[model samples]
Target: MAAPTADSASPADSTDPTNPADPTRPVLDCRGVWKTFGKGRDRTPVLRGIDLAVHEHEVVVLIGASGSGKSTLLRCVNLLERVDDGTIHLDGDDITDPRVNADAVRQRIGIVFQAFNLFPHLTVLDNITLAPRRVHRRARAEAEQAALDLLDRVGLAGKAREYPDRLSGGQQQRAAIVRALVNSPRLMLFDEVTSALDPELVGEVLALVSDLKGDGMTMVIATHEMGFARRVADRVCFLDRGVILEQGRPEQVLDNPAEPRTRQFLQRLLDTEPA
Candidate 1:
């Protein structure tokens, strides 16, 4: 079967086409993106032509069932997985270009996964400052001070000297988030960040994300927490069969979805839970 067709209409600029290269454009833009795994006859397309634009300070959430291509889409955006076709523009630069330095592009975007992946022996402060001090060439004192400030903001200042194992699951997750933020990324991508947490711990990690949103951070998140998504996402996109079936304001997409597939998916998700 053929992949889904690319739709270049951006929710932020479906009307304006004058200065397509405007400097103050969307922080992340994926045009006609396609990704596949496996080889030859066994090849399976995960992201079948996803075109999306995430404006500055906007919170865009990707929603779908398992294997619906939500994680693949985010991976392609982060360049963790290469696209089979199409262009990805990060702040007006074609980051998908073969000539582009992947490491350089990655430095500008922060991504967090379901796993904390923090170093076991490193103190919380060390975990957060490692990249900035080593990769960006910041002085040790400067990086440590900045890391402390971020930890304080998340109410983990007292635990900065503690190792990842010493902190609660929620604290570890929040520390991971702060580690990402220390790089001062232009965009942030999250893939089921709270999925591994205990139910009670989920809210602590989520609260830090809420604080980031309030501070005008540009983020693209994939999550199963529909209630949090509804509250924090400026827009929510429903994916199906490797395509974005529908996207709009959270209220519209989550409450009055026009796509039957999306409605069915949401219904099944809600039904699985007592809510």
Candidate 2:
């Protein structure tokens, strides 16, 4: 995995379509990001001075405790939550700028949350095709064809016609991932995707995500599954109290953490894991 490097350089030219991950830049860049909620003295800082860069095809996994700000960081990247400070760049474009079109930028990002959030009335195919049809103006046949191909890729070809209610929790989550992929996004974000699934069902969703990484997808994932994180991540970031306390290769960070906070955190997680 390519590690993020800090840069004090000015923004690249807009006319230049140079790849952000082309050794000189990262595909997803979050520079000095800070996010907070509430007002005045009651303010709560969720993310503090976060500077992360994800190069093309790199998988960066964030591991932390419940209040560590992992979800908030992902939300900030997708522009679902506005950042209180700093800049977020996607493929060299400053996505956090108020002038940037939010919908247009979202077309290039695929995010899957803990919830499936599939439309109960829609078939799996419809759920997957909704964004392409309504937002991208893709014709019905074209969108359905793409959705079918994605479903097949995830071993859910036969479930395309099935309603969300008819599928198992794992199946529903997989469909949700497919829905996010219908736009063919350049960046994928997963926010504890398997947290809501039964242990037996969690493997299927995690397997699909691992396969996505094999396909060279650049992704930023927040997961409690330490095993899954070790298997998929090129780099691991451990957050503590809204800040990245330690980050390194999975072997170094997950196995032999340099920071005491990280070591204690990983030890607690290990204690909870079944024998």
Candidate 3:
């Protein structure tokens, strides 16, 4: 896979011609995007103005303290949380437009949450197959086969018949990842995926992600695992106060940080002993 070329288009343009030529047109692009919460007069801006681009087969990690809009930014990429301003493009197609089919867009971009959202009533195999069978109109046999293959890729093939509750936190998270990957999405969004795991189980989940990174899966992860960010991310972005404070290569941003806020955040994160 190739790297994405820089694009300079206004939010209004529906098409991004540069994308096709580049071959690495970002799988996700958010430009000057904003999001607000609350009703009418008391609305609070959660994402002020976020500008981010994620290329094909690249892993971009977003780091920030609580309420820094890191999660919101990831949500906006998939339109789970709509932006109040600016534009979001997926595969060079504008998704911010009201006329776009959000469900279709979502199918191309899979998201894994901190809380594994697997259905308790369903077995791991069913949990992974349900979406493809329903949304893509795939035959049950076909979906099941794909799900099994994905489960194997995630090292959870033997647990196909197990329920979510029957699995450990790490196992459950890996199942969630397999569920998302079964769709063969062009981009993957991970919002603090390891935050809910037990300390003893975090390493297992991170190892799965590291393996995915090695496979050149395009991913945007919001996390506090500086070590994972340093190791897997092609680029690291430090977000603060609903804005990106600084962004660069992991070595530059995590080790030789230029921004005071980034340096402070790293210091605080490093103060804690490794889990």
Candidate 4:
């Protein structure tokens, strides 16, 4: 698939993102956000004036080609990367502000990447309890109980005592997800989480995410899995060249896109699929 060019449409031209608003404030709100890497002549812009809002219990899926700023946007929202312009608000608090406590902000948000990133030496239980025990200052027994409960929920209760290397790719990723959830984050960010798993393993992870949606966990997922996106997303945002070119209900954006760029991108994904 082709990367969206800057000439396609400006952020000003995109549709409003507040279509699915509710009485409660959005869990995540990004306004005119921008991020650029490098300096001087080597500067490469990754995100440009991205405006998006993810309301409570809403699942917003971001779809675009590689380097279209999907991961970068998620990173920015997580406060791993600072925005060069604009602001990011989590639960109405401006987390982008310099005064904001990034670590504290992170405690409320959970982000899982394609890689499992579990510690090789730590058991699955240890991996899940590390953050809550150390950062949140929860007692060992309390943290362990919580971890075990979450592990059970994700079908990994028996594997809690097993080290990372002993588990399969699907189990490891689910372990990683359980680690993220053990913190009780108010919002979740999934960045191509199933990309590293085998085809057969992918469903288990997707099913877990579906269950999270059913539990009303607000999420912003960046994924190449269009079918999963269609099934899970409350709204689908077609990001192009660092801006949302189109967004609406899943069927509207994925099956009947209004923009030519959106249609072209979707067609490329369909063309690459195996018979």
TM per model? 0.93, 0.92, 0.91, 0.92
- Candidate 3 per-residue lDDT, tens place, 71-161, comes to 8888888888878998888877889998989999999988999999999999999999988999999999999999988788778989999
Error of 1 at 119 (Å): 2.0
Ranking of all predicted structures according to TM-score, beginning with the best and ending with the worst: 1, 2, 4, 3
lDDT of 2: 0.87
Which rank order by lDDT, best down to worst?
A: 4, 2, 1, 3
| Per-model CA lDDT versus the true structure | 0.87, 0.87, 0.85, 0.88
- The TM-score, computed over Cα atoms with residue i paired to residue i, of candidate 4 is 0.92
Candidate RMSDs in Å, in order, are 2.8, 4.0, 4.1, 4.9
lDDT of 1 by residue, 173-247 (tens): 999999999999999999999999999999999988999999999999999999999999998999888888998
| Candidate 1 residue spans exceeding 4 A from truth | 1-24
The clash count of every prediction, one per candidate, is 0, 0, 0, 0
Off by over 4 Å in 4: 1-24
Model 2 compared with the native: what TM-score?
0.92
- Best-performing candidate as measured by TM-score: 1
How do the residues 52-92 of candidate 2 rate in per-residue lDDT, one tens digit apiece? 87878889999999989999999999999999987888888
